[model samples]
Target: MDPNEVPDDDAATSGGALPRRAPGPPRPAPIAEIDALSGDPSFMTSLARGLAVIRAFSERRKSMTIAQISQKTGIPRAAVRRCLFTLAQLGYVHDDNRSFSLLPKVMSLGHAYLSSTPLPVMAQPFLDHVREALHEACSLAILDGDDILYIARSATTTRIMSVDLKIGSRLPAYCTSMGRVLLAAMPQAELDAYLLREELKPLTDRTITSRASLLQALAAVRQNGWAIVDQELELGLRSLAVPIHDTSGTVMGAMNVSVQAARVPVKELETRFLPVLLEASRELSMQLL
Candidate 1:
C-alpha cells in the first residue's frame, strides 16, 4: 500500500470522529463573529440577516417555508419573513403560497463577481485543456478564510465525489490537495493563525487530524511544489494539486485534478499528472502577468 493510503478498516483518526449526523439535512455551520459584529458601527445587522436567509437555501434544501428558513439560519421567524418579503419584492426570490424558492435573477449576484474578476475568466481555458487532455476532472481554487473556494471547474461526465462541486462550492482547507498547496504558500504567521483558528475535523479515516502530521504534510508541499491527498477529503477520492503564482512569484491560487482512488493508484498522481499540472500552473501564472 502507498504510505499515504490508509486502509478502509483503519480505526478512527487521531483527533476524533465526526459528530453523528442528524436526520434530514445537516445543520448549517454557525455564522462566525455575528455577535461581535453587532457592536461595530459599520456592520449592518439587517443586511447580514438578509444574506443569511438567502444562503440558507441549498441543493438539499431548495424550497423552504418561513419557519424552515428561520430554523436553518437561526434567524427569527419575523426577520426571515421580512427578508423573504424584501427578496421577493426585488425578484431575487419567489413565493408560492407555502414555500419560497430562489429565482433565476439570483444568478446576477454571482455573475457580478464572475464578470468583474479576471481569475475565473483566465482559468477556464486552462482547466478545459487539462480536462480534455487527461479526461479527468480539474478545478481552480483560491483560499477563502479557512476554506478553499472553487472559482472554476472542468468536470468529467463520470462523477467521482459524493458532493457535487462547482464554482462557489467550498471545502475545508485542511485536507484538500489544492488547499494544501495554497496553505503551504502562506506566510508563517498567517499559516499559524489558520492552524490555530480552524478545527481539523476528520472527514474520513485517512484524514490527518494530528497537528504534527498535518504540519509535516504542509512542509512537504512547500518543499515539493505540489500536493497529493489520498482519500482524506472523502473516501475513494484522491487529488493532486500545484500552486499557481503571479508575476511577482507569489502564490495566488491552486490548480488540481481529481480522480477516483479505486480507479487510479496513488503513484500515478506524481508520475502521470504532476508534469502536466505543473506546466499548466506555470502557463496560467504567466498569463496573470
Candidate 2:
C-alpha cells in the first residue's frame, strides 16, 4: 500500500476528534491595523492602502467603482479615492469617469517577481514535462499565511475545478493537496498556531473540518512525503502533491498534478502520477541546490 494513503481506521487511532460543525461561509481575511499604522512614521499606510486597492481588482472583478473598491478592501472611501487617484495618475489604473480598471502596467509588478525569482524559472521546464507526461495540469504553490498561492503552473485546456486557476490563485491550506504538503513541512509550533487561528470551513462534502482529522491527515503527509487530496477543494478535482525542498533540505513550496476525479481514481494517482510528480520535484530541488 502507498504510505500516503491512510486507511479509514486511521481516524480512530487519533485521540479526541472534534465534533463536526455545520458548514458556514468561508472566513474573511483578517483586517490589518490600518489605523494603528497611520501613526507610525516608518510604516507607510498610504502605500499599503494603495497596494490593497490594486489587489481588490481581479479576473472576476475587472472594473469597479470607488465604493466597490472600498467595500472590497475595507478601506474608507476617502482613502480608497486617494489611492485610486494616485494609481491613476501614475498610469497604473484607468478611470472611465464611472468605474476604474487596472491597466496593462499592473503586469510589470508580477513580471518583476517572475523575472527575479529562480524558483518559477527553474521549475517551468520540469512542470511542463510533468504536465506533458501525465496529460494533467501541474502547478507550483507556496504557503502564504493560511492559504496556498500559485506562483507557477502548466495547464491543459480542460477545466478541472469551478474556479479559473492561474498564477496568483489563492486557496485554503487545510484542504488542498499542495497546501497539505506545505503545511506538513511546517514546524510543529507554526503548524499549531495556524490550526489555532484559521477556521477550517468545509469547501466540499469530503473536506476535513475536524481539527483532529486534519492533524492526522497532515501527519500522514509528513510520513509519506506527499499528499493526495480527493475533491476536497472542489468537486471533480483530485490532486497529488509533493514538497519542493531547497539545498538545506527545507521545504520552500509544493508541486502538484491535478486531474478530473471522474477520469482518474486515487489508486491510479498514487501508482502512476505520484512517481512523475516526485521526479519533477526532485529535479527542481536539484537546481535550487
Candidate 3:
C-alpha cells in the first residue's frame, strides 16, 4: 500500500495523524520530464530548452544567473546561456552582465494565447455575474498538468487567500475545489495515473493528504456534479466548484466561488451558492457550444 494511505489502526498507534508536509515553492519543469521526447523527430529540443529557461524566472527569482537557471531547469549551463542569448536577442529577456531577467516583450507570448482563446473572454461576464451575485470571488480555470491554472477571475474587495491570485496563477489540483471537479471528470485511467504521481502534501492541517480519502472525495464530486473543498488549500479558505462542459458534453474547465471559511458555512455553499454556480456554468457551457 502507498504511504499516503494510512490505516486507522496505524494512525491510532502513532498517537496522532501523520505530520503534514509543506511543499516548497514551485520550480520550472525539469528537462528530465521531456527526456523521453529527445529521440522523437517531431520534438523541438531547442525551443523546449528556451521555454524551460524562461520558466526558471519567477516572482521571487526575478533575475537569475546561467548556473541558477541551469540548476532550476536541469539544462546544462552552456545550453541555458545559449537560450538566454537567443531570448535576449529576440527582446524576450535582458542580461546585465551577471543575471538575466524577462523583458516586457515576453508579455506578448501570454497575450497571444489569451487573445486567441475564447474561453477567458467569454467567461469574464459570467464570472463577473457570479461574483456580483455571491459577493465572493469567482474564477474560471482549467486543469493544467497537476495544477489548476486560473484564466479569468472576478474578485471582491475582501481578499480571502494569502496569495493574490489572477490570470496565470496556478494551485495544486488535489486539494482545490475546482481541481477536484476537473479531476472527477477525468477518465479512470488518467485519474489513476495522476493519483499515483502527485504528492498529496498538505497545505493545511485540514487538507486531505490521504490518496484513498481524495479518491472518495472525487467520487462524491462525480455523484453530486459539484465539489466543495473546505479549508483544504488554505486554513480559512473554502471553495465550491462545478464543471464547465463543451458542445459534446465534455468537461472543458471548472468555475468556482471562494469564500472565507469563517464567514460562510459549507451548508451555505451547497444550499445557497450551488444553484447559481450550476446555472452560470450551464450558461458558459452553452456559450462554448
Candidate 4:
C-alpha cells in the first residue's frame, strides 16, 4: 500500500473505538503575498497560487472540481482553472473535464528533496535494522511546523495504525512520541511560539490537551533523552522515540518504533524496545558525525 494514500475508511482502527489517524495541522489559507519578496518584481503571485492549487489535493481529497479547489485554496475559480490547465499541460495533473487529479509526476517534487538530502537515505538502513531487531514498525521523521513529517520508514506487515503512513505522512506534534522528542529539542523561544500558535485538539481520551501537561511531557523527554507516547495518537498504538543528532550535536530528526498497545505493553516498550531504539539512534548519529 502506498504510504501517501489515505485509507478509504477514515475512522478505521486496529483495536480501538477511536480513529487511529489523528487530525493533522489545519491547512493554512492561501498566501496573499510573498512577504519576504514584497517589492521584488521577480516574486510571482501567480506561481505561488499555482503551487497552492497543487497542494489543494491531498490524501483525503484525491480529486476535485475547479470549484472545490477554489474553495479549499481560497483562490479565485478562474485562477484555479488556469492553474489546473497549466499543471495539466505540464503533465503534473490529469484533467477528466469535470475534476482534476494529480499524476505520478507530482512525486518528482518530493523526489528532488529526498535525492538531495542524505538524511533519509542514511537513516533507512538503521531503521531497517531496528525494525528487524524489534519486530515493529520503525520510522524517521522531522518536525515540520506543528507536525512531524515522516521522511523514511520500515513498516511491519501487521498494521498498527489505521492510516497509511508513508514517507510524506504528517501527524500532530503534540500527540506523537517522535513529535515529543523533536519538540523537546527545540530552543525555548521556538517551542513557546509553536505552543502559542498551534491549537491542541484531543484525539483520544489519553491525549494531552492542556499546554501545561504537554510542556511537562516535553520537559521529561528533554531530560531523559527519549519519549514514550502510549495510546495518545491512537487508542491501540504506543510508540517510543529518541532524538537523532548530527556532528554538531544538533537534533536532526527522531527515530521511533511503534507497536500495538495490547501486544506490547508500556513496560515491555520501555524495557525491551527503548534500548534498541536508543542504540539505533546512536548509530545513525555517529554516521552523521
Candidate 5:
C-alpha cells in the first residue's frame, strides 16, 4: 500500500515501525543526483562523457569491450577503459575480462528514483486509465533544456506521430504539449533565459515563433492548468496536456494524450480529453508526500 494509503498503525512491522523523518531538505530529490550545474564547460564536458559511457550500453549492446565502447561512444580506448574501471569500482558495472555490462546493483540508481519517488508510482494506473479513456498515446515528460524528455509512456496501437515515441526520446519542448506545462511552472527570469536561448524555429506552420507569443501562451497554460497544440510539433498531430504537481506544488511533470487531427477534433480534445487529464493529475497529486 502507499504511504498515504496507510495510517500510523498500519506502518508498523513485526518488531518496530518505520523510523520517523526529521525535517530534511525542501525537496526530497533522489540520492546520487548531481548538484545544480555550473556554466564551466570542462565540468559539463566530463559529466557528459561519463553519461555517454553509461548510455553506450543499452538493450542491444548489453556487453561491450573497450574497443566496442570506443566505437559506440567515440571515446579513445584508453578513456573507455578508465571509465569502465571507475564504474566497476563504484559497483555500478561488472566485467568478465573480455566484456563489460551493468550489474543489477546499477539498477539502484533508477530504483532510488522509482521507489522513493512518489509521482511515477501514482502515475502508472492513471496512465493506463488515460490511455483507455482517450484511445491514443499518453505520456509523461520532464523538462530537459529546450526539449521535453519522455520518462514514461503508454500508447494505443494506432500511432499518432511518425517519430518513434520511445520513453527517452526528446523533442522541442516549445512545440510539444508537455513542454508548455513545464514552461508555465518556471520563474520569469528562467523563462526569459529559455526563450532567448531556444531558437524560435517553426517545427511546422502551426508552431509558436515569437518570444512574446510564447510567453502569452505560457501565461494561458498557468491560468488554465493545461495546454493543447495542433500540428505544432509534427504534421496532422494534436495533443492535450495537464500539469502534475508534487506535494510541494512544484511541476513534477506534464502528462498528455496525442492523437491524429484527422481522427480527433479540437472540440473533442477540450471536451472529452481534458476531463480525463485533469482527473489523472488530481489522482497523481494525492499520492505525493
Candidate 6:
C-alpha cells in the first residue's frame, strides 16, 4: 500500500485508510499567517497582501498573473506585485519566467489551524466512531466564502475526486452537501450576496453550475434542515450533511458523510445517513457551546 494509503495510527481510516494535496505549481502549501510579522504592526500590510495573494491561488486557478491577482483580490496591481515579490524572496512563493505561484511555505498557515485549533482534535475520535458505525467517510467543514474548507476528515481510502484533498481542503459550497448545510444557516442577505458574487462552476456533469438552480437548492436545504448532494461534487460520491450550531443557535460548522453512489441512493442518504449525521452534528455543536 502507498504511504498515504496506510493508517497513520491504530485509528481506522475511512474505507480503510490515507492523503494531502499540494496547493499547486510553485504553489507552496497555504500558510495563513506570518510568524515574524505578529509582533510588529509594520508587517501588517505586508502580511495582509501576502496572505491575499496566497488565497488567490485555488483549485480553479492554481497559477496567476499579477493582473489576475489584482482582479481577484481587489488590490492594486502594484501592491499585488510587491507582495508576490516579497513572498518569492522569502521562499514563500515562486517566480518562473513570468508566472507566480505559492510554495510549501504556504502550508504553514493551514498547518496553524490544524495545530492550534482544538475543534478538529476533539472531533477526530467522534468522527471515527460515527464513520465506523455508518461505514462511510465523514468530514467536518467550515464556510469560507462560496466554498467549504475540510478542516477534519474521517476519510475513506477511496480516491474519488479528480484532485486529492486532505485536511484544509476547499471545495465550492453550492455543489456539496456540506456547503448547503452551512449555507442554509446563513442569513438571507449574506446568502443572496454570495449567490450574486459567485457564479457556480460545473465540477462534474451533475454539478449545479447555474445560479438560479443553486438558489432553489439552497432554499430547500434551508427548509429541510439538512442537505443531500448526489454526484454534484464528483461522480459516484454521494454525501449527506447537517448544520452544527452553537448554544445560541449560531452555526459553528457542518458535518458530512460521503458514500459510494452505487451503494446508496439519495433517498437512502436522507433515510439512513441523515439521522446519524444529525446526531453527530448536535453533539459537536453542544461541545462547541
The lDDT of each candidate is: 0.83, 0.84, 0.86, 0.84, 0.75, 0.76
Give per-model TM-scores: 0.83, 0.84, 0.85, 0.84, 0.67, 0.73
RMSD of 2: 13.0
Q: lDDT at 219 for candidate 3?
A: 95
- What are the per-residue Cα lDDT tens digits for candidate 3 across 16-118? 4333535766433566554445555566667777887887777668899988998898676766787899999999999899999999898888889889989
| Candidate 5 error regions (>4 Å) | 1-45, 52-112
Considering lDDT, which of the candidate structures 4 and 6 is the better prediction for this target? 4
Q: Report the number of clashing residue pairs per model.
A: 0, 0, 0, 0, 0, 14
Better of 3 and 5 by TM-score: 3
lDDT of 5 by residue, 128-212 (tens): 8899887777898889766787777887777667776866667788888899989999998998888866777898998999888
C-alpha root-mean-square deviation, each candidate: 11.9, 13.0, 11.5, 11.3, 14.2, 14.1
Candidate 4 C-alpha lDDT tens digits along 170-280 = 899999999999999999999998898777888999999999999999999989999999999999999999999999999999999999889998999889998899999
TM-score of 4: 0.84
Regions of model 4 farther than 4 Å from truth: 1-43
* Candidate 1 Cα misplacement greater than 4 A, ranges: 1-30
In candidate 6, position 27 carries an lDDT of 28
Flag the better candidate by lDDT, 1 or 5: 1
Q: Give candidate 6 misplaced runs (Cα > 4 Å).
A: 1-48, 59-80, 95-101, 209-212
Of 1 and 5, the candidate ranking higher by TM-score = 1
- Sorted by TM-score (best first), the order is 3, 2, 4, 1, 6, 5
